[model samples]
Structures are given as structure tokens and as C-alpha cells.
Target: MRADARKNYEHLLTVARKVFTEQGNDASLRDIARRAEVGLGTLYRHFPTREALLEALLRTSFGALAKRADELQASSDSADALITWLQEIIAFTHEHRGVIAPMVSAIEDHESALHASCVTLRSAGAALLARAQADGKARADLDGSELFDLIAALAWLREQPSHASRADRIFGVISGAILARRP
Candidate 1:
């Protein structure tokens, strides 16, 4: 790309991320173009659709999350790795409010551009979950998909950071139910 075009592309992406985070998926494309000081055509030239923009904005974070899960799984205990990964997912969602709903839907829609990223995010902690279950540390019945929804639930409650205590209590209950009971 040419220098000016590259500059415009980068600026639009930065502005779009801010606008989308502040106003959500329904954030106006024209508003994004105005904020980026670019034409709507330019924005469209770079991102053909709103979902495309959303996918672009989320890709790096999801990639980082997958990498983090790998690193944690390699270095941490089975159950500990899964817990740490879940917390990181909650943190990621907090950074990008209103994104979870789209992600949840896209993950189930194989045709969505964001679907693969969601799958990567889901699979990240899944290995740890499997490892824990196999090691007799976690419940065999629950899988990573359940943990995925649980993390999303925690992210949805992020407005009340003070709810950490309540979250911890709930998580404790879940852990007790999911952890293997020794004789």
C-alpha cells in the first residue's frame, strides 16, 4: 500500500476500535469514518463489513490468548492452568465490552469471519481442561465449552468489579462440583 493509504488504514482501524468499544457493534460506520478523518469509501476499502472490522480488532487479542494458554499449560499445573486461562479470558472481555455477544454467535456460525478466532480462543483452555480431567483433577462431565460460557458470564458481570468476591464464591462452588472427589 501507498504511504497515505497505509496511514489512513491504520488510523481507521484505531478509531474504529475506540468507537466500537465505546458504542458497541452498532457503532456508526460514518461516525468511525469521521473520527478517523477519512471518507466512508476509505473505511469500506479497508474493511468490507462491520464484522470484518470486528474480526480485525479481535484477532490479535485472541491470538495472544491462545499463545498465553499454551504457555500456561506448559508451565503450570493442569487445574491451575485452566483457572488462569479463564481469568485471562475474563480480562480480555473486559477490555472489549459488547464483543462477547457477537463472538458467541459467530463461534456457532461457521460462515462468520470471526468464527475461527473464537474457536482458537475456545480451544486454548480446552487442552488444559482435558489435561486436568485426565489427571483426575477435574470433572469428566464438564468440557471446555462449559468453561467458555462461564468465562463469558464472568465477563458480563465485569461492570461490578466489586463482584469479585461473589464471583470467587461462585467459582469455588463450581470448582467443588467439578473437582474430583477423593475417597
Candidate 2:
């Protein structure tokens, strides 16, 4: 891509992320182009469909999350690392709630990109949980699948307009439950 084209693409992603957050996944792509100071043709050239745009956004976001998990694993305290990772995930979900609904629907509809994202997140969370459990900081019985379910539930809850704060509370409760000292 040309320098200007790359710049416009990045700008579109930034504008689209904010627009989707404020206006949901069905937000106007034309308006996004207008806000980004790019033409509608440019937006379509970069993101051919709504699903394509959503997948790109999620891939970008989740890729960062996976990197954070890797960094957390390299940190000193395993328990604190797990807590920090969970907190970051919760914050990401909160910020991307508008896209969550459509991404989830796409997943249910067998979208390959969304499925790959789910697999990546599941693997990252499992690695973190395994490390925490092995270090004797987390519950030995809690599997990755269970933890993923909890995160998904929290994400869905965070997506609701009325339940914005619920994700934090849920995270706290889950962290305590998983990391509490065993008798």
C-alpha cells in the first residue's frame, strides 16, 4: 500500500473503532469515511464488508491482548500476573462492547476469523491459568474452559448498557474465587 493509503487505512480503523463503540456495529461506514477524512471508496477498499471490518478490529485488539498475556507470563508474581491479565481483558471487553455482539453472532454463524480469535484467546487464557495453578496461586480444579466461559459471560454482561460496572465486580469475584488460599 502507498504511504497515504496506509495512513488512511490506519485512520479508518481508529475512527471505526470509536464509531462502533458509540454507534454499535451497524454504524454507517460512509460516516466513518467522512470522519476519517477518507472517501467511501477508500473504506470499502480496505474493509469490503461489515464483518471484514469487525474481524480486523477484533484481530487487532485480541492480538494485543495475546501479547499482554505473554508479557504477564514473563512477570514475577504468577498470581498478580493472572489478575492483571484478567483486568486487562475486562477493560478490552468494556471498550469494545459494540463489536462484541456482532463478533459473537459471526462466531455462531461459523465465521472463520472469529473462530480463530476464539481459539487464540482460549489458548492464551489456558496458558495463564495453567501457570497460575502450577505455581499454587490459583485453584487447581479450575480448567481453562471454565475460565474462558467466565470471561465470555463477563464480556457479554459488560456489553449491556445497564451492566457496564458488572464486569469489574465479576472479575473481582472470579479472581478471589480462583486465587483464594485453599484451606
Candidate 3:
């Protein structure tokens, strides 16, 4: 890419991040282009679709979340690692607001721009869950896909104004259910 083009791309991402944070994942592309002081055509040149733009914006964070899972696996107790990673992913989805829908859909859609990142993150969570189960710390009936679905549900609550206040309490409830009984 040319220097000017690269600058525009970066600028768009910055502006899009702000806009998405304020208005959510459904924020208008035209508004992002306007905020970035770029033409809509220019935005399209860099990101042909909304999913493409989202994938670009979220790729780094997705990698970090996966890496965090790996770090937790090595450094934390099995159940603690699993719960910590779950909390992080839930917080991540809350930060991006309204991203859970696209992420959930992308997991089953190989051609989606977000598919690879979503799959990798899910696999990371799955590994943590498997480790916990192996250690007899988490419920054996739960699998990675179910864990991902639970995340989606939990994150959906966070996105709602009415439910946001209780989201953490509910997270505690869900996490408790995932753990095995000690006595």
C-alpha cells in the first residue's frame, strides 16, 4: 500500500474503534468514513465489508486473548485458568459490544472474515476447559462449543442495558455450575 493509503487505513481503524465503542458493532460504516475524514469508497477499498472491517479491528485482540489462555494454562491452576479465561473473553466481548452475534455466526462460517480468529479463540477456551475437566475441576459434560455458547449468552446479557448490572452475578452462577463439587 502507498503511504497515504496506509495512513487512511490506520486512521479509519482508529475512528472505527471509537465509533464502535460508543455505538457498538452495528455502527454505520458511512459514519466511520466520515469520522475518519475519508471517502466511503476509500473505506471500501480497504475493507469491502463490515465483517472485513471488524476482522481487521479485532484481529490483534483475538490473538491476545488466545495467547492469554495459553499463558493461563501454563501459570494458573486448571479451574482457575478456565474461569479466568472465561472472564477475560466475556469482558472482551463486552468491550466490543454487539460482537457476540458476528463471532458466534463466524465460527460456523468458514468463509467469514472473522472465522479464523473466532475458531482460534474458541479452541483456546476449549483447551482450558479440557485441562480443567482432566484435573476433575470442571464438569465433564461441558465441551468447548458449549463453553463458547455460554460465553455468547453471557455476553448478550452484558449488551443489554437492563441486564448489564446483573451480568457479573450471572457469570458467577454459570461458572459455579461448570466446576465440580469438592465434597
Candidate 4:
């Protein structure tokens, strides 16, 4: 891309992330274009679609999560590593208001722009989960997919206005279930 084009792309992405963070996925593309001082055609040329824009914005985050998984797998207690990464996943979900909905959908729909990254994030968590299970810290029956879903559900619950305060307790209950039973 040309220098001007690259600048516009990065500016659009910055404005889009701000708009989405404030007004969620429903935020207008036109508003993003306006804020970025770019034309709608330019935005379309770069992103093509809302999902594409979101995928572009989240690609770094997904990569970071994968890297975090690698670090966690060796950094400390297996259970603590899993818990820490789970919190990061939760925080990532909470970064934008409605992102979790699309993320969940993307996990199931390979046609979605975010599908591959979502799978990568899930597999990252799964590796940590496997390590936990191997260390006898987590339930062996639970796999990475299950753990990923559990974190998504908990993150969604944490966002709910009514249940928000109890999220830690809810997370605790789920965490307990994920742990192996003493013989």
C-alpha cells in the first residue's frame, strides 16, 4: 500500500476501534470514516466489511493471546497459568461491548473472518489446559474447547448488569469444577 493509503487504513482502524469501544459493533461505519477523516469508499477498500474491520483490529490481540499462552505454559503453577490466561480472555471479551457475540459465532462458523483467529485463541488456551491436566491440577476430561466455552460464558455473565458483581464468585465455582478431585 502507498504511504497515504496505509495512513488512512491505520487511521480508520484507530477510529473504528474507538467507535466500536464506545458504541459497539453497531457503531456506524460512516461515523468511523468521518472520525478518521476518510471516505467511506476508502474504508470499504481497506476493510470490505464490518467483520473484516473487526478481524483486522483483533488480529494483534489474538496473536498476543497465543503468545501469552506460550509464556504461561512454562512460567508458573499450571493452575495459576490457566487462571491468569482465563482472566486475560475475559478482559479481551470485555474490551468491546458486543465483541463476544461475534467471537462466539466465529468459533462455530468457519466462513466468518474471525474464525481462524478464534480457533487459534482456543487452541492456545487448550495447550495451557493440557498442561494443567498433565500436572494433575485440572480435570483431565475437560478439553480446550470446553474451557474456552466456559470462559466465554463466564465473560458474558460478567458483562451482564445484574450478575456483574458476582462474576468472581461464578468464576470461582467454575474453576473449582475444572480442578481434579482429590483421591
Best by lDDT: 3
Error of 2 at 108 (Å): 6.5
Give the per-residue lDDT digits (tens) of candidate 4, residues 115-148: 9999999999999989989999999899988888
Order of quality (lDDT):
3, 4, 1, 2
| Superposition error at 1 for model 3 (Å) | 1.4
lDDT of 3 by residue, 135-175 (tens): 99999999999999999999999989999999999999999
TM-score for each of the candidates: 0.87, 0.77, 0.97, 0.94
Best by TM-score: 3
Pairs with steric clashes in candidate 1: none
Task: Please give the distance, in angstroms, between residue 127's alpha carbon in candidate 4 and its true position after superposition.
Answer: 0.5
List model 2 lDDT by residue over 20-102, tens digit each.
Answer: 88887779999899999988998999998877877788897788888889989998888898888877886787776565565
- Give the clashing pairs for model 2: none
Q: Lowest-lDDT window of 10 residues in candidate 1?
A: 156-165
Candidate 4 local distance difference test against the native: 0.89
Where does model 1 exceed 4 Å of error? 159-165
lDDT of 1 by residue, 1-183 (tens): 999988988898899888978887779999999999888999999999888888988899899999998898786578777777777787778778778888888878998989999999888877878888988888898887887787777776663568755876776676567677866
lDDT of 1: 0.82
Tell me, what's the RMSD of every candidate?
2.4, 3.0, 0.9, 1.3
Task: Candidate 4: list runs displaced more than 4 Å.
Answer: none
Stretch of 10 with least lDDT, candidate 2? 99-108
